[model samples]
Target: MTAEHGPGASDIDESRIPSWIACEDLLVKMREELIDRAIKLLNREIESGHIAVNGSTLFSSEANADVEEAMYLINNLIDDSGRLHKEYSEYIEKNNGKKLSDAEAKKFGELQKFVLSVEQLNMLMEYARVLSSWADAAGKMIEGKDTEDILRKTIDKEELRKTVLEFFINDSECRVLLSSKEIEAIKSVLGA
Candidate 1:
Protein backbone atom coordinates (compact mmCIF):
# COMPACT_ATOMS: atom_id res chain seq x y z
CA MET A 1 0.00 0.00 0.00
CA THR A 2 1.29 3.43 -0.93
CA ALA A 3 0.95 6.25 1.65
CA GLU A 4 -0.65 9.46 0.39
CA HIS A 5 1.56 12.62 0.56
CA GLY A 6 -0.01 15.66 2.35
CA PRO A 7 0.92 19.23 3.45
CA GLY A 8 2.84 17.68 6.35
CA ALA A 9 5.16 16.03 3.87
CA SER A 10 6.04 19.34 2.17
CA ASP A 11 8.42 21.73 3.93
CA ILE A 12 6.73 25.05 4.81
CA ASP A 13 8.26 27.80 2.76
CA GLU A 14 8.71 30.83 5.05
CA SER A 15 11.30 32.86 3.13
CA ARG A 16 9.18 36.01 3.58
CA ILE A 17 9.24 36.39 7.34
CA PRO A 18 10.46 39.86 8.29
CA SER A 19 13.22 40.16 10.84
CA TRP A 20 12.32 41.61 14.23
CA ILE A 21 13.53 45.18 14.31
CA ALA A 22 12.53 45.27 17.94
CA CYS A 23 15.57 43.18 18.90
CA GLU A 24 17.96 45.75 17.51
CA ASP A 25 15.96 48.55 19.05
CA LEU A 26 16.03 46.88 22.44
CA LEU A 27 19.80 46.32 22.21
CA VAL A 28 20.28 50.00 21.45
CA LYS A 29 18.14 50.93 24.41
CA MET A 30 20.14 48.57 26.62
CA ARG A 31 23.43 50.13 25.52
CA GLU A 32 22.11 53.60 26.28
CA GLU A 33 20.99 52.47 29.70
CA LEU A 34 24.42 51.02 30.44
CA ILE A 35 26.16 54.28 29.47
CA ASP A 36 23.75 56.33 31.54
CA ARG A 37 24.22 54.14 34.56
CA ALA A 38 28.00 54.46 34.25
CA ILE A 39 27.84 58.24 34.14
CA LYS A 40 25.53 58.30 37.13
CA LEU A 41 27.86 56.05 39.11
CA LEU A 42 30.81 58.26 38.22
CA ASN A 43 28.95 61.38 39.32
CA ARG A 44 27.98 59.73 42.57
CA GLU A 45 31.58 58.82 43.29
CA ILE A 46 32.72 62.37 42.60
CA GLU A 47 29.96 63.89 44.72
CA SER A 48 30.80 61.61 47.62
CA GLY A 49 34.37 63.02 47.59
CA HIS A 50 35.76 59.60 46.87
CA ILE A 51 37.75 60.84 43.89
CA ALA A 52 38.27 64.50 44.76
CA VAL A 53 39.45 64.30 48.36
CA ASN A 54 42.88 63.38 49.64
CA GLY A 55 42.53 60.45 51.96
CA SER A 56 43.82 56.98 52.73
CA THR A 57 43.93 54.98 49.52
CA LEU A 58 41.15 52.45 49.06
CA PHE A 59 43.17 50.07 46.84
CA SER A 60 46.80 49.22 47.55
CA SER A 61 49.29 48.70 44.74
CA GLU A 62 48.48 45.02 44.19
CA ALA A 63 44.78 45.73 44.44
CA ASN A 64 45.12 48.54 41.96
CA ALA A 65 46.72 46.18 39.48
CA ASP A 66 43.86 43.73 39.93
CA VAL A 67 41.37 46.51 39.38
CA GLU A 68 43.11 47.49 36.18
CA GLU A 69 42.95 43.90 35.01
CA ALA A 70 39.22 43.89 35.62
CA MET A 71 38.91 47.09 33.63
CA TYR A 72 40.80 45.50 30.76
CA LEU A 73 38.33 42.64 30.73
CA ILE A 74 35.43 45.07 30.63
CA ASN A 75 36.98 46.97 27.74
CA ASN A 76 37.33 43.73 25.85
CA LEU A 77 33.71 42.90 26.52
CA ILE A 78 32.61 46.27 25.16
CA ASP A 79 34.65 45.76 22.00
CA ASP A 80 33.21 42.29 21.49
CA SER A 81 29.71 43.53 22.22
CA GLY A 82 30.09 46.24 19.63
CA ARG A 83 31.23 43.71 17.08
CA LEU A 84 28.26 41.44 17.81
CA HIS A 85 25.90 44.37 17.43
CA LYS A 86 27.40 45.15 14.06
CA GLU A 87 27.04 41.56 13.01
CA TYR A 88 23.41 41.48 14.09
CA SER A 89 22.67 44.61 12.13
CA GLU A 90 24.32 43.21 9.07
CA TYR A 91 22.36 39.96 9.39
CA ILE A 92 19.12 41.87 9.73
CA GLU A 93 19.88 44.01 6.72
CA LYS A 94 20.88 41.06 4.60
CA ASN A 95 17.83 39.08 5.58
CA ASN A 96 15.34 41.90 5.52
CA GLY A 97 11.88 40.60 4.55
CA LYS A 98 13.24 37.04 4.84
CA LYS A 99 11.50 34.71 7.25
CA LEU A 100 13.57 33.23 10.03
CA SER A 101 12.96 29.73 11.35
CA ASP A 102 12.20 29.08 14.98
CA ALA A 103 15.78 28.02 15.40
CA GLU A 104 16.93 31.37 14.10
CA ALA A 105 14.78 33.21 16.59
CA LYS A 106 16.29 31.14 19.37
CA LYS A 107 19.75 32.03 18.14
CA PHE A 108 18.81 35.69 18.14
CA GLY A 109 17.68 35.37 21.73
CA GLU A 110 21.09 33.97 22.66
CA LEU A 111 22.73 36.89 20.90
CA GLN A 112 20.65 39.22 23.04
CA LYS A 113 22.09 37.58 26.13
CA PHE A 114 25.57 38.44 24.88
CA VAL A 115 24.41 42.00 24.33
CA LEU A 116 23.24 42.21 27.93
CA SER A 117 26.52 40.79 29.17
CA VAL A 118 28.33 43.53 27.32
CA GLU A 119 26.05 46.11 28.89
CA GLN A 120 27.00 44.86 32.33
CA LEU A 121 30.66 44.89 31.37
CA ASN A 122 30.37 48.50 30.28
CA MET A 123 28.91 49.47 33.63
CA LEU A 124 31.82 47.79 35.37
CA MET A 125 34.33 49.65 33.19
CA GLU A 126 32.62 52.92 33.91
CA TYR A 127 32.91 52.28 37.61
CA ALA A 128 36.61 51.50 37.22
CA ARG A 129 37.19 54.69 35.24
CA VAL A 130 35.52 56.72 37.98
CA LEU A 131 37.70 55.12 40.64
CA SER A 132 40.86 55.62 38.62
CA SER A 133 40.09 59.28 38.04
CA TRP A 134 39.38 59.78 41.70
CA ALA A 135 42.63 58.13 42.71
CA ASP A 136 44.61 60.40 40.43
CA ALA A 137 42.86 63.49 41.72
CA ALA A 138 43.36 62.51 45.30
CA GLY A 139 47.03 61.86 44.66
CA LYS A 140 47.41 65.31 43.19
CA MET A 141 45.60 66.83 46.14
CA ILE A 142 48.13 65.13 48.39
CA GLU A 143 51.12 66.37 46.38
CA GLY A 144 50.79 70.03 47.26
CA LYS A 145 48.49 72.92 48.14
CA ASP A 146 48.95 74.27 44.63
CA THR A 147 47.44 71.04 43.27
CA GLU A 148 44.19 71.86 44.99
CA ASP A 149 44.18 75.31 43.42
CA ILE A 150 44.89 73.78 40.03
CA LEU A 151 42.02 71.32 40.35
CA ARG A 152 39.64 74.05 41.43
CA LYS A 153 40.62 76.25 38.51
CA THR A 154 40.70 73.51 35.90
CA ILE A 155 37.13 72.27 36.51
CA ASP A 156 34.60 73.99 38.65
CA LYS A 157 34.12 70.66 40.40
CA GLU A 158 30.91 71.68 42.06
CA GLU A 159 29.42 73.14 38.91
CA LEU A 160 30.54 70.26 36.74
CA ARG A 161 29.18 67.79 39.23
CA LYS A 162 25.79 69.44 39.13
CA THR A 163 25.77 69.60 35.37
CA VAL A 164 26.77 65.95 34.96
CA LEU A 165 24.09 64.83 37.38
CA GLU A 166 21.52 66.92 35.57
CA PHE A 167 22.51 65.43 32.24
CA PHE A 168 22.24 61.91 33.64
CA ILE A 169 18.84 62.45 35.21
CA ASN A 170 17.36 64.36 32.27
CA ASP A 171 18.67 62.04 29.61
CA SER A 172 15.87 60.56 27.48
CA GLU A 173 17.27 57.05 27.92
CA CYS A 174 17.47 57.49 31.68
CA ARG A 175 13.91 58.74 31.99
CA VAL A 176 12.58 55.26 31.33
CA LEU A 177 14.51 53.56 34.14
CA LEU A 178 13.80 56.49 36.48
CA SER A 179 10.36 57.90 37.19
CA SER A 180 9.56 61.60 37.16
CA LYS A 181 9.33 61.63 40.93
CA GLU A 182 12.65 59.80 41.21
CA ILE A 183 14.24 62.22 38.80
CA GLU A 184 12.98 65.12 40.90
CA ALA A 185 14.48 63.54 43.99
CA ILE A 186 17.80 63.10 42.25
CA LYS A 187 17.70 66.69 41.02
CA SER A 188 17.03 67.92 44.53
CA VAL A 189 19.98 65.96 45.87
CA LEU A 190 22.22 67.14 43.05
CA GLY A 191 20.98 70.71 43.57
CA ALA A 192 20.11 70.86 39.90
Candidate 2:
Protein backbone atom coordinates (compact mmCIF):
# COMPACT_ATOMS: atom_id res chain seq x y z
CA MET A 1 0.00 0.00 0.00
CA THR A 2 1.20 3.54 -0.70
CA ALA A 3 2.15 5.59 2.33
CA GLU A 4 0.14 8.46 3.76
CA HIS A 5 2.23 11.53 4.60
CA GLY A 6 2.09 13.66 7.77
CA PRO A 7 1.55 12.68 11.36
CA GLY A 8 -0.24 9.45 12.38
CA ALA A 9 0.40 7.28 9.31
CA SER A 10 -2.97 6.03 8.02
CA ASP A 11 -4.38 9.54 8.28
CA ILE A 12 -3.30 12.94 9.41
CA ASP A 13 -4.47 13.91 12.85
CA GLU A 14 -5.80 17.42 12.99
CA SER A 15 -4.13 18.14 16.33
CA ARG A 16 -0.72 17.97 14.74
CA ILE A 17 -1.56 20.83 12.43
CA PRO A 18 0.44 24.00 12.76
CA SER A 19 -1.00 26.82 14.82
CA TRP A 20 -2.59 29.92 13.38
CA ILE A 21 0.31 31.92 12.00
CA ALA A 22 1.06 35.51 12.91
CA CYS A 23 1.65 38.31 10.40
CA GLU A 24 5.11 39.03 11.78
CA ASP A 25 6.65 36.22 9.74
CA LEU A 26 4.01 35.76 7.13
CA LEU A 27 6.34 34.91 4.26
CA VAL A 28 8.19 32.22 6.16
CA LYS A 29 4.95 30.78 7.44
CA MET A 30 3.52 30.65 3.92
CA ARG A 31 6.46 28.64 2.67
CA GLU A 32 5.94 26.09 5.39
CA GLU A 33 2.21 25.86 4.72
CA LEU A 34 2.81 25.49 0.98
CA ILE A 35 5.14 22.58 1.53
CA ASP A 36 2.72 20.95 3.93
CA ARG A 37 -0.09 21.34 1.43
CA ALA A 38 1.87 19.77 -1.41
CA ILE A 39 2.67 16.79 0.72
CA LYS A 40 -0.93 16.40 1.84
CA LEU A 41 -2.24 16.70 -1.70
CA LEU A 42 0.05 13.98 -2.95
CA ASN A 43 -0.71 11.76 0.00
CA ARG A 44 -4.41 12.08 -0.64
CA GLU A 45 -3.82 10.89 -4.17
CA ILE A 46 -1.83 7.92 -2.93
CA GLU A 47 -4.43 6.94 -0.38
CA SER A 48 -7.14 7.03 -3.01
CA GLY A 49 -5.12 4.58 -5.09
CA HIS A 50 -5.33 7.05 -7.97
CA ILE A 51 -1.64 7.42 -8.65
CA ALA A 52 -2.02 5.69 -12.01
CA VAL A 53 -5.35 6.10 -13.75
CA ASN A 54 -5.06 4.03 -16.89
CA GLY A 55 -6.11 0.96 -14.91
CA SER A 56 -2.48 -0.04 -14.88
CA THR A 57 -2.00 -3.01 -12.54
CA LEU A 58 -2.50 -1.45 -9.14
CA PHE A 59 0.16 -3.66 -7.56
CA SER A 60 2.41 -3.86 -10.57
CA SER A 61 5.87 -2.45 -11.05
CA GLU A 62 4.66 0.15 -13.52
CA ALA A 63 2.11 1.53 -11.07
CA ASN A 64 4.72 1.78 -8.35
CA ALA A 65 7.10 3.55 -10.70
CA ASP A 66 4.41 6.01 -11.68
CA VAL A 67 3.72 6.86 -8.05
CA GLU A 68 7.43 7.23 -7.37
CA GLU A 69 7.81 9.61 -10.30
CA ALA A 70 4.92 11.77 -9.17
CA MET A 71 6.29 11.93 -5.65
CA TYR A 72 9.73 12.89 -6.96
CA LEU A 73 8.37 15.74 -9.05
CA ILE A 74 6.26 17.14 -6.21
CA ASN A 75 9.18 16.85 -3.81
CA ASN A 76 11.46 18.62 -6.26
CA LEU A 77 8.98 21.45 -6.76
CA ILE A 78 8.62 21.97 -3.02
CA ASP A 79 12.40 21.94 -2.60
CA ASP A 80 12.84 24.55 -5.32
CA SER A 81 10.18 26.77 -3.75
CA GLY A 82 12.02 26.64 -0.45
CA ARG A 83 15.28 27.39 -2.23
CA LEU A 84 13.75 30.46 -3.83
CA HIS A 85 12.85 31.89 -0.41
CA LYS A 86 16.32 31.11 0.90
CA GLU A 87 17.93 32.86 -2.05
CA TYR A 88 15.73 35.90 -1.58
CA SER A 89 16.69 36.09 2.10
CA GLU A 90 20.35 35.85 1.18
CA TYR A 91 19.88 38.57 -1.40
CA ILE A 92 18.43 40.85 1.23
CA GLU A 93 21.17 40.05 3.73
CA LYS A 94 23.87 40.65 1.14
CA ASN A 95 22.37 44.07 0.53
CA ASN A 96 23.52 45.25 3.97
CA GLY A 97 20.63 43.58 5.85
CA LYS A 98 18.32 46.16 4.34
CA LYS A 99 15.10 44.44 3.39
CA LEU A 100 14.53 47.29 0.97
CA SER A 101 17.62 46.56 -1.09
CA ASP A 102 19.85 49.49 -2.17
CA ALA A 103 18.72 53.14 -2.32
CA GLU A 104 17.55 52.38 -5.81
CA ALA A 105 15.04 49.93 -4.31
CA LYS A 106 12.31 52.55 -3.98
CA LYS A 107 11.12 55.76 -2.25
CA PHE A 108 9.44 54.66 0.92
CA GLY A 109 12.03 56.60 2.94
CA GLU A 110 11.13 55.93 6.59
CA LEU A 111 8.65 53.22 5.64
CA GLN A 112 10.87 51.34 3.22
CA LYS A 113 10.90 48.23 5.37
CA PHE A 114 7.14 48.10 5.60
CA VAL A 115 6.70 48.56 1.88
CA LEU A 116 9.36 46.02 1.01
CA SER A 117 7.80 43.58 3.43
CA VAL A 118 4.55 43.78 1.53
CA GLU A 119 6.35 43.31 -1.76
CA GLN A 120 8.22 40.31 -0.47
CA LEU A 121 5.00 38.83 0.90
CA ASN A 122 3.41 39.23 -2.50
CA MET A 123 6.30 37.42 -4.14
CA LEU A 124 5.98 34.53 -1.68
CA MET A 125 2.26 34.27 -2.26
CA GLU A 126 2.82 34.18 -5.99
CA TYR A 127 5.32 31.40 -5.54
CA ALA A 128 2.82 29.52 -3.39
CA ARG A 129 0.17 29.98 -6.03
CA VAL A 130 2.35 28.31 -8.63
CA LEU A 131 3.00 25.38 -6.35
CA SER A 132 -0.70 25.10 -5.57
CA SER A 133 -1.46 25.00 -9.29
CA TRP A 134 0.86 22.05 -9.66
CA ALA A 135 -0.80 20.33 -6.74
CA ASP A 136 -4.17 20.91 -8.38
CA ALA A 137 -2.96 19.21 -11.53
CA ALA A 138 -1.59 16.36 -9.51
CA GLY A 139 -4.95 16.03 -7.79
CA LYS A 140 -6.73 15.97 -11.13
CA MET A 141 -4.38 13.30 -12.39
CA ILE A 142 -5.14 11.16 -9.37
CA GLU A 143 -8.76 11.74 -8.30
CA GLY A 144 -9.93 13.09 -11.65
CA LYS A 145 -12.04 15.66 -9.85
CA ASP A 146 -12.28 19.44 -9.76
CA THR A 147 -9.63 21.09 -7.56
CA GLU A 148 -11.24 24.45 -6.98
CA ASP A 149 -11.70 23.87 -3.27
CA ILE A 150 -8.24 22.48 -2.81
CA LEU A 151 -6.67 25.34 -4.72
CA ARG A 152 -8.61 27.90 -2.75
CA LYS A 153 -7.59 26.40 0.56
CA THR A 154 -3.94 26.25 -0.44
CA ILE A 155 -3.59 29.60 -2.21
CA ASP A 156 -6.19 32.21 -2.98
CA LYS A 157 -5.55 33.15 -6.60
CA GLU A 158 -7.71 36.27 -6.62
CA GLU A 159 -6.06 37.60 -3.48
CA LEU A 160 -2.60 36.81 -4.74
CA ARG A 161 -3.15 38.71 -7.98
CA LYS A 162 -5.99 41.18 -7.57
CA THR A 163 -5.72 42.05 -3.91
CA VAL A 164 -2.04 42.69 -4.18
CA LEU A 165 -2.70 45.09 -7.01
CA GLU A 166 -5.26 46.92 -4.91
CA PHE A 167 -2.88 47.11 -1.98
CA PHE A 168 -0.10 48.51 -4.13
CA ILE A 169 -2.21 50.63 -6.46
CA ASN A 170 -4.73 52.18 -4.11
CA ASP A 171 -4.33 51.52 -0.42
CA SER A 172 -3.03 54.57 1.46
CA GLU A 173 -1.31 52.49 4.13
CA CYS A 174 0.73 50.71 1.46
CA ARG A 175 1.06 53.71 -0.82
CA VAL A 176 4.46 54.83 0.41
CA LEU A 177 5.95 51.35 0.63
CA LEU A 178 7.60 51.78 -2.72
CA SER A 179 8.16 54.91 -4.75
CA SER A 180 7.21 55.19 -8.41
CA LYS A 181 10.82 54.70 -9.44
CA GLU A 182 11.38 51.75 -7.12
CA ILE A 183 8.23 50.07 -8.40
CA GLU A 184 9.90 49.67 -11.77
CA ALA A 185 12.76 47.79 -10.20
CA ILE A 186 10.34 45.65 -8.20
CA LYS A 187 8.34 44.97 -11.32
CA SER A 188 11.47 43.84 -13.06
CA VAL A 189 12.53 41.68 -10.12
CA LEU A 190 9.07 40.16 -9.73
CA GLY A 191 8.66 39.99 -13.51
CA ALA A 192 5.40 41.94 -13.31
Candidate 3:
Protein backbone atom coordinates (compact mmCIF):
# COMPACT_ATOMS: atom_id res chain seq x y z
CA MET A 1 0.00 0.00 0.00
CA THR A 2 1.07 3.55 -0.50
CA ALA A 3 0.31 6.89 1.14
CA GLU A 4 -1.96 7.68 -1.78
CA HIS A 5 -4.19 4.73 -0.93
CA GLY A 6 -5.30 6.04 2.46
CA PRO A 7 -4.21 6.55 6.01
CA GLY A 8 -2.68 3.64 7.95
CA ALA A 9 -1.83 1.82 4.73
CA SER A 10 1.63 3.30 4.58
CA ASP A 11 4.07 5.29 6.64
CA ILE A 12 2.09 7.93 8.52
CA ASP A 13 4.03 11.13 8.25
CA GLU A 14 4.20 12.98 11.52
CA SER A 15 4.35 16.27 9.68
CA ARG A 16 1.22 15.51 7.66
CA ILE A 17 -0.96 14.88 10.67
CA PRO A 18 -2.07 18.11 12.31
CA SER A 19 -0.35 19.05 15.55
CA TRP A 20 -2.39 18.24 18.60
CA ILE A 21 -2.42 21.86 19.67
CA ALA A 22 -3.77 22.86 16.30
CA CYS A 23 -6.37 20.11 16.33
CA GLU A 24 -7.43 21.06 19.83
CA ASP A 25 -7.81 24.67 18.85
CA LEU A 26 -9.80 23.69 15.80
CA LEU A 27 -12.05 21.46 17.87
CA VAL A 28 -12.67 24.15 20.45
CA LYS A 29 -13.51 26.77 17.88
CA MET A 30 -15.67 24.38 15.91
CA ARG A 31 -17.50 23.31 19.04
CA GLU A 32 -18.27 26.86 20.03
CA GLU A 33 -19.36 27.90 16.54
CA LEU A 34 -21.53 24.84 16.04
CA ILE A 35 -23.14 25.22 19.44
CA ASP A 36 -23.88 28.85 18.81
CA ARG A 37 -25.42 28.13 15.43
CA ALA A 38 -27.44 25.27 16.86
CA ILE A 39 -28.81 27.37 19.67
CA LYS A 40 -29.89 30.14 17.34
CA LEU A 41 -31.49 27.83 14.79
CA LEU A 42 -33.14 25.79 17.53
CA ASN A 43 -34.65 28.86 19.08
CA ARG A 44 -36.01 29.87 15.71
CA GLU A 45 -37.47 26.44 15.08
CA ILE A 46 -39.05 26.15 18.50
CA GLU A 47 -40.81 29.38 17.84
CA SER A 48 -41.94 28.07 14.45
CA GLY A 49 -43.28 24.72 15.79
CA HIS A 50 -40.71 22.56 14.01
CA ILE A 51 -38.37 20.55 16.17
CA ALA A 52 -35.93 17.73 15.52
CA VAL A 53 -35.89 14.49 17.44
CA ASN A 54 -35.19 10.88 16.54
CA GLY A 55 -38.47 10.72 14.62
CA SER A 56 -40.59 10.64 17.76
CA THR A 57 -42.64 13.53 19.00
CA LEU A 58 -42.36 14.04 22.69
CA PHE A 59 -44.25 16.19 25.12
CA SER A 60 -42.70 19.57 25.69
CA SER A 61 -41.19 18.80 29.08
CA GLU A 62 -39.96 15.39 27.97
CA ALA A 63 -38.48 16.88 24.85
CA ASN A 64 -36.77 19.50 26.91
CA ALA A 65 -35.14 16.88 29.13
CA ASP A 66 -34.03 14.82 26.18
CA VAL A 67 -32.59 17.85 24.43
CA GLU A 68 -30.69 18.78 27.53
CA GLU A 69 -29.28 15.28 27.63
CA ALA A 70 -28.27 15.51 24.00
CA MET A 71 -26.52 18.79 24.61
CA TYR A 72 -24.64 17.20 27.49
CA LEU A 73 -23.62 14.26 25.35
CA ILE A 74 -22.46 16.47 22.50
CA ASN A 75 -20.42 18.54 24.89
CA ASN A 76 -18.83 15.46 26.37
CA LEU A 77 -17.88 14.13 22.95
CA ILE A 78 -16.18 17.41 22.03
CA ASP A 79 -14.42 17.51 25.36
CA ASP A 80 -13.17 13.97 24.87
CA SER A 81 -11.89 14.83 21.44
CA GLY A 82 -10.07 17.82 22.85
CA ARG A 83 -8.45 15.61 25.47
CA LEU A 84 -7.41 13.14 22.80
CA HIS A 85 -5.69 15.96 20.96
CA LYS A 86 -3.88 16.99 24.12
CA GLU A 87 -2.71 13.43 24.68
CA TYR A 88 -1.42 13.29 21.13
CA SER A 89 0.42 16.54 21.73
CA GLU A 90 2.00 15.13 24.87
CA TYR A 91 3.05 11.97 23.04
CA ILE A 92 4.66 13.98 20.26
CA GLU A 93 6.37 16.25 22.74
CA LYS A 94 7.66 13.36 24.83
CA ASN A 95 9.45 12.02 21.76
CA ASN A 96 10.97 15.45 21.01
CA GLY A 97 9.25 15.44 17.59
CA LYS A 98 11.08 12.31 16.53
CA LYS A 99 9.46 10.03 13.98
CA LEU A 100 6.93 7.80 15.68
CA SER A 101 7.31 4.04 15.62
CA ASP A 102 4.87 2.06 13.53
CA ALA A 103 2.77 1.22 16.56
CA GLU A 104 2.66 4.80 17.75
CA ALA A 105 1.85 6.05 14.29
CA LYS A 106 -1.03 3.61 14.05
CA LYS A 107 -2.39 4.72 17.37
CA PHE A 108 -2.02 8.43 16.74
CA GLY A 109 -3.27 8.05 13.20
CA GLU A 110 -6.47 6.55 14.53
CA LEU A 111 -6.82 9.40 16.99
CA GLN A 112 -6.35 11.99 14.30
CA LYS A 113 -8.83 10.24 12.06
CA PHE A 114 -11.42 10.18 14.81
CA VAL A 115 -10.95 13.82 15.64
CA LEU A 116 -11.25 14.82 12.01
CA SER A 117 -14.36 12.74 11.62
CA VAL A 118 -15.95 14.48 14.57
CA GLU A 119 -15.09 17.83 13.06
CA GLN A 120 -16.82 16.93 9.81
CA LEU A 121 -19.93 15.50 11.41
CA ASN A 122 -22.03 18.68 11.10
CA MET A 123 -22.81 18.79 14.77
CA LEU A 124 -24.93 21.86 14.28
CA MET A 125 -27.84 19.85 12.91
CA GLU A 126 -27.94 17.42 15.78
CA TYR A 127 -27.52 20.17 18.33
CA ALA A 128 -30.28 22.22 16.78
CA ARG A 129 -32.69 19.33 17.02
CA VAL A 130 -31.82 18.63 20.60
CA LEU A 131 -31.80 22.24 21.70
CA SER A 132 -35.00 22.98 19.82
CA SER A 133 -36.70 20.40 21.95
CA TRP A 134 -35.29 21.93 25.07
CA ALA A 135 -36.34 25.40 24.07
CA ASP A 136 -39.77 24.08 23.15
CA ALA A 137 -40.26 22.67 26.59
CA ALA A 138 -38.81 25.70 28.28
CA GLY A 139 -40.88 27.96 26.10
CA LYS A 140 -44.04 26.08 26.98
CA MET A 141 -43.20 26.14 30.62
CA ILE A 142 -42.77 29.87 30.45
CA GLU A 143 -45.46 30.67 27.90
CA GLY A 144 -48.25 32.81 29.27
CA LYS A 145 -49.47 36.39 29.28
CA ASP A 146 -48.42 36.86 32.86
CA THR A 147 -45.33 34.66 33.28
CA GLU A 148 -43.52 36.66 35.91
CA ASP A 149 -44.12 33.96 38.49
CA ILE A 150 -43.52 31.11 36.04
CA LEU A 151 -40.22 32.61 34.92
CA ARG A 152 -39.09 32.86 38.49
CA LYS A 153 -40.06 29.25 39.11
CA THR A 154 -38.61 27.79 35.94
CA ILE A 155 -35.06 29.19 36.10
CA ASP A 156 -33.01 31.23 38.49
CA LYS A 157 -33.91 34.87 38.01
CA GLU A 158 -30.46 36.03 38.99
CA GLU A 159 -28.83 33.59 36.61
CA LEU A 160 -31.06 34.68 33.79
CA ARG A 161 -30.29 38.26 34.64
CA LYS A 162 -26.63 37.54 34.63
CA THR A 163 -26.84 35.68 31.37
CA VAL A 164 -28.55 38.60 29.74
CA LEU A 165 -26.00 40.99 31.11
CA GLU A 166 -23.12 38.83 29.99
CA PHE A 167 -24.68 38.39 26.57
CA PHE A 168 -24.70 42.11 26.10
CA ILE A 169 -21.31 42.51 27.66
CA ASN A 170 -19.79 40.04 25.23
CA ASP A 171 -21.73 41.36 22.26
CA SER A 172 -22.65 37.87 21.22
CA GLU A 173 -24.58 37.45 18.01
CA CYS A 174 -26.17 34.14 18.89
CA ARG A 175 -29.84 34.17 19.55
CA VAL A 176 -31.22 33.67 23.02
CA LEU A 177 -31.92 30.11 24.07
CA LEU A 178 -35.67 30.64 24.17
CA SER A 179 -38.38 31.62 21.75
CA SER A 180 -38.84 35.28 21.09
CA LYS A 181 -42.08 35.44 23.03
CA GLU A 182 -40.53 33.48 25.86
CA ILE A 183 -37.58 35.83 25.82
CA GLU A 184 -39.88 38.80 26.06
CA ALA A 185 -41.56 37.33 29.08
CA ILE A 186 -38.23 36.51 30.65
CA LYS A 187 -37.04 40.03 30.02
CA SER A 188 -40.14 41.38 31.61
CA VAL A 189 -39.57 39.21 34.62
CA LEU A 190 -35.85 40.00 34.86
CA GLY A 191 -36.31 43.58 33.78
CA ALA A 192 -33.52 43.18 31.27
lDDT of each: 0.44, 0.40, 0.43
| TM-score top scorer | 1
Q: Which ten residues in a row are the worst by lDDT in model 3?
A: 3-12
lDDT of 1 by residue, 108-155 (tens): 555555455556556545544443343344343432223223233323
After superposition, candidate 3 runs with Cα above 4 Å error:
1-79, 88-143, 147-149, 156-172, 175-184, 189-191
Greater TM-score among 1 and 3 belongs to: 1
Return the TM-score for each candidate structure: 0.36, 0.23, 0.27
lDDT score for residue 182 of model 2: 29
lDDT of each residue in 121-174, candidate 2, tens digit only: 445445566544444433433322222222233433444533443334343433
**Residue range 19-121, candidate 3, lDDT tens digits:** 3322222223323555655455444443444333344434457647755655554555555656755776676457655688999777666555544444433
- Which structure is stronger by TM-score: 2 or 3? 3
Clashing pairs in 2: none
